[model samples]
Target: MLKHPDTTNAATSKLAATFASQQQAARAQPYPDYRSRLHALTQLEQQFKQQLNALAAALSEDFGHRCAEESLRIELLPTLQGLAYQQRKLKRWMKPEKRHTSWLFQPASNFIQYQPKGVVGIMVPWNYPVFLTLGPLMAALAAGNRVMLKLSEDTPATNQCLQHLLAAVFPDEQVAVFSGDAKQAADFAALPFDHLLFTGSTAVGRKVMQAAAANLTPVTLELGGKSPAIIAADANLAVSAERLIFGKCANAGQTCVAPDYLWVDAQIEPALIHAMKGAFTRLYPASRLQQDYSWLCTERQRLRMRTLLQQAEQAGATIISCAEHSWQHYLNDGSGLLPLQLVLNLPEDHALWQQEIFGPILPIRSFSTIEHIFTELSTQARPLALYVFSDDKALQQRFLKHSHSGGVCLNDCLMQVAQDDLPFGGIGASGIGAYHGKEGFHTFSHAKAVHSKGWWHPGKLIYPPYNKNWLNTALRWLLRR
Candidate 1:
């Protein structure tokens, strides 16, 4: 059961005290040098590796029946790769980057010093808790900042496991974790911090930003939108269906980047639908669907997804459920498990088409021409990820140039985020900032520009009153360039 967050003085005081201690610790160590930062990251990596199996098990327990293998592959693998990538590049990233100096300031030095932003707050969503939490947490630590994390109330088991793992490895002043209901989450967001990063729905993301605004804290929001999959006319049906099925079905479509709706060429819509059904059935056969697949996290969430499907059907949408007994079987069962439900002909005003369908429900739309996609995309909120499947290089390049998204995957799905070097984030309605690799390091650091002069007073000459003829001549000559 969820309760409103306790906003009484006691709760607020506790949170504020935690923030104060972290701020104090940050002041004590001001800037952790390269060696210290590297050591901190190494400690994090080793601790995470030691607790890897336990983390997977806890995640499974939280989801009722999340596949342990899937948790290891999707949640654990990329996070380890990210940590190693940071370790390999931390040394050079920490160095002061040399910048060009103007002719007026020649014989002097100019560079930027990457300074830690003191303390950072990270808010994790229920889905992929480990990846989302550690991804940003590692970046903040690597940038040499103390961090406080607020785990989702939705996953108590995983949160407890992860909180213990972090506590065992790091002291409170270095890394801390907080847990509470949504209202409590709001209180956490209102705290004063050097930087705050949140990963969740766009609706909650807005509230987080508004709370952080009181402190004028900078934030990085990884919010979700209805990411779309565009299948070009030249795309191979078998290949496209296979790739999309895995992306949408993995995590049972709870992923923020999962394809919410697909736009296929009208001519091949039937053929592609057949291919998608075949692909889904082959991947998750009815006999083993419950055993191998993950259930919706909670009964509440499961019913919300069901309500979306029911409302769509009420509004005259066609549903093609793939699995044992189809989607109808779960309506009365205590289990929140739902198989892949492909919806079509849903009314334009239905909520299924309006909101981010973060479940195993995918709405398929057929487009007569590729250009029509741009017209629709232009009006809707910009998504965090976009999938364009096309064998034709010309059409592929067209999406790359015309569409706007946080990231684009060519001929693939969800693999874009696996690249440790790419900066992952969204724009416009999708999200505010990015974090991954070098961009991640910089996001948690303040780049302070430094200009040094070696006893040369040439700049002083132009600082005086502009009455002298020589000064006027010099200014005129400089302005000409």
Candidate 2:
């Protein structure tokens, strides 16, 4: 249900007051020392550990039947690890970086101070709610910034759990959580935050950017598109299928970085399909009935997937189900379950081929040559991730050099995002800016460059003296560039 405009306006006004308070707090202590930052991170980590089971249960309740084990593995573990990584490195990251000055500026020095951007606004997504909410919050806190998180309306259960967890450790001025409907989200986006981070679909990301632009707020959008998995001619079919299927099947292919489609050599198409089927059966013999298999988060998402599948089937595309039983069996029970399907030979104009499939439907296309793969991908927006499976270094290098994506994972899938040292984000339409590890710290920080000079410096020689021979020489040298 949508929120009333008056209620949304009241919430927005209260949020504005909190933002102002935090801004004032930041002014009082512009930079938090390493000890204080570490303490905050430590408190968050302890609270997360305490609420692990509750969080998993809340997530399961929100998603109808999300596996607690999958939640622990995917969302909880990574967040804890990220916090630890930040804690261990906060001291070094907090130190100002020394920079070199040109020879002409001898006795002068330059350095960069990483200062926190005050009052960061984090807009969370329904899928992987805990991870997305806490992930950006970790970065913002690590950079010594206050945070205001707007929780997703679709995950009310999880939001309540998270709200309790946050309320126990921090004051409202430090970290606040807001929960509301779509109208509230629009109002929240309109706030003049120092920085805003949103994670969701490409269509909505555009609107978020527009709202942020009104206040000239810097934004980091983690949007999703149709990321692809390519199989080289010389690749191992079984290995490629296993890794790709794992990523596509996790969370029932609701992951933003999940392989949306596949491009394989024509000769190995049959072999890859057979391998993938075997892998799926071995992993989950009951398919959607398996304990760890997650259902589509909402009924609307389920209907969207069904419509896309029906459209493809009507367009003369072959649909191959990976389930051991009929898909209707699960659907009849009102489980919102969907089978992992391999869609073959979808027409270019088909919705299955055009839209980002956020379900367990993999569109497989055959490519005779590498050039053909490049041509097909060139027509679409830049994807957030690209997966390549090949043992040949030359082929891998060729694909890496020819294509553009936010991140590339070779011989695997979705594991690059787990690496704390690397930056996770998108390029063109996939997303804007990145955050993870030091990149995340810098993303939420302002890199202010400071230049210091001594009184006995060479700058006096070049200060508005047109008649002096030394000044003329200095000007000529400086202008030589």
Error of 1 at 151 (Å): 0.3
lDDT of candidate 2 over 1-481, digit per residue (tens) = 5567787788878878888888888888888888888999999999999999999999999888898989998889999999999999999999999999998788899999999998899999998899999999999999999999999988999999999999999998899999887877898899999999999999999999999999999999999899999998899888888898889988889899999999999989999999999888877777335587888998888888878877888999988988865554555668867768999988988887778999899999999888888887787799999999999998889778988899999999999999999999999999999999999999999999999998799876657746899778867887997
- The positional error of residue 155 in candidate 1, measured at the CA in angstroms, is 0.7
lDDT of 2: 0.90
Error of 2 at 94 (Å): 0.9
Show how many residue pairs clash in every candidate, following the order shown. Answer: 1, 0
> How many backbone overlaps does candidate 2 show?
0
**Each model's TM-score, in the order given?**
0.97, 0.97
Candidate 1 similarity to native, TM-score: 0.97
lDDT of model 1, residue 348: 83
